[model samples]
Target: MDSPSLDPAWTQRQRPPRLERRLGFADYPQVQNFLERLERLCERRQRYPDLGFGRTYVNLTIYPDQDATNVGDAEEDFARDIDGLLN
Candidate 1:
């Protein structure tokens, strides 16, 4: 395997596979559905944190130091699974 270059900001950037332009829906139903999904994900994260792997991880930059890191990690895994399903 080729070794990566020496870079200071390599881990901080999230580059997309490709970039594209598109219109976003601002309609009521779309907005409502989005809010509902966000709420549901939050609830799931709070209620059940061990839905994915037994191990959990958390990023310390955003959230306050707490015991819910496992839950957040599970939520991310859950979201990624849904994205995979859709694609």
Candidate 2:
């Protein structure tokens, strides 16, 4: 079997894949729906974190979709999951 380092794509600084999706967050309900879908996808794909004792964790990072002018409040809202609507 070929080792990872032996592969052609392997290098000193191999870039990891960036899984990005441009989701819309115009309102609370929409944000909640997005979170629900994200959670379901994690569960379906079994993308849970291992804690070395059989316990699993689901980590999420919510961010704003607005530009520089609308960043502050919208960013806060996104970080807080649309005022806890996503919780």
- Best candidate (score: lDDT): 2
Clashing pairs in 2: none
lDDT of 2 by residue, 15-83 (tens): 222111233455666555656665565475444211111122223332323233322343333333322
- Following a full C-alpha superposition, what root-mean-square deviation does model 1 have from the true structure? 13.5
lDDT by residue (tens digit), candidate 1, 13-34? 1231111112133465654554
TM-score of each: 0.31, 0.33
Q: Which regions of candidate 1 fall more than 4 Å away from where they truly are?
A: 1-23, 47-87
lDDT of 1: 0.32
Residue 4's lDDT in candidate 2: 23
Candidate 2 lDDT: 0.34
Q: Number of clashes in every candidate structure?
A: 0, 0
What is residue 76's positional error in candidate 1, in angstroms?
A: 5.0
Each candidate's lDDT (Cα)?
A: 0.32, 0.34
Clashing pairs in 1: none
